[model samples]
Target: KRRLEDGEDVLISGFGKFCVKEKKVRKGRNPSTGEVMMLDKRRVVTFKCSGKLKKKINGK
Candidate 1:
């Protein structure tokens, strides 16, 4: 988590990779109010399973 916060990616070899991605500010709408609002740009953490992990999960 700290590495991701520091803008560094973390990899666990055969497990997976954790990365931080930036999202641009954009427009969004509320489902109930139908009011449009600007969403702030922010960083988000994402995960991508390694090929080995994927294969294991798929039982292949």
Candidate 2:
């Protein structure tokens, strides 16, 4: 949800796919080697929450 709100692509497990608009290439750092890496732009997936589902959680 935060990723979608930030206009960034998000991949969801079990779900299909979603294309993010205004995609951009990103540079990241490697944890082990501490080396910088480049990440290519790609599509991502996201899910929408249902109001009924929220109500059920709140009931608990």
Candidate 3:
């Protein structure tokens, strides 16, 4: 949790990898109003499953 808060990647050998990515400020649109707006830069966490985990999930 601390590492994630610090924007660091965390890996679990047989499970998956958690990546901390930096997103730049960019333009976005509001679906309802169709108005353009600027989004603030922020950190996002993404996860990628390991091959072992994927295989298990697929019942391999």
Candidate 4:
């Protein structure tokens, strides 16, 4: 949210508010009951790499 507000898309690996998203809902199965269930959408934190970081990893 901060990043978006700042008009920045790049983010580091460890810490930042931009490294998150609202996960979408989907169908899933319960392991214990072997029954189908609807999974609710929720916000989740995630990590994404910048182009510079990707280049460094590939170069190595």
Q: Each prediction's TM-score against the native? A: 0.94, 0.54, 0.87, 0.54
Ten contiguous residues with the weakest lDDT in model 4: 10-19
User: Quick one: best lDDT, which candidate?
Assistant: 3
lDDT of 2 by residue, 7-57 (tens): 775654444334356547999899999999998886565455455655666
Lowest lDDT 10-residue stretch of candidate 2: 11-20
**Number of backbone-clashing residue pairs for each candidate, in the order shown:** 0, 0, 0, 0
User: Per-residue CA lDDT of candidate 3, range 1-60, in tens?
Assistant: 999999889999999999999999999999999999999999999999999999999999
Stretch of 10 with least lDDT, candidate 1 = 1-10
Model 2 stretches astray by more than 4 angstroms: 1-23
**lDDT of candidate 2 at residue 37, scale 0 to 100:** 96
Cα error of candidate 4 at position 10, Å: 8.3
User: What is the Å distance of residue 37 in model 3 from its true position?
Assistant: 0.8
Clashes of 4: 0
Residue-level lDDT of model 1, residues 1-60, one tens digit each, is: 789889999999999999999999999999999999999999999999999999999999
The CA root-mean-square deviation of candidate 2, after full C-alpha superposition on the true structure, stands at: 8.7
Decreasing lDDT order of the candidates: 3, 1, 4, 2
Cα-based lDDT at residue 11, candidate 4:
58
lDDT of 4 by residue, 1-60 (tens): 666545455455543335446679999999999999999997665666666667787895
Give stretches of model 4 more than 4 Å off.
1-10, 13-18
The residue-level lDDT of candidate 2 at 14 comes to 41
lDDT of 2 at 13: 42
Model 2 clashes, total count: 0
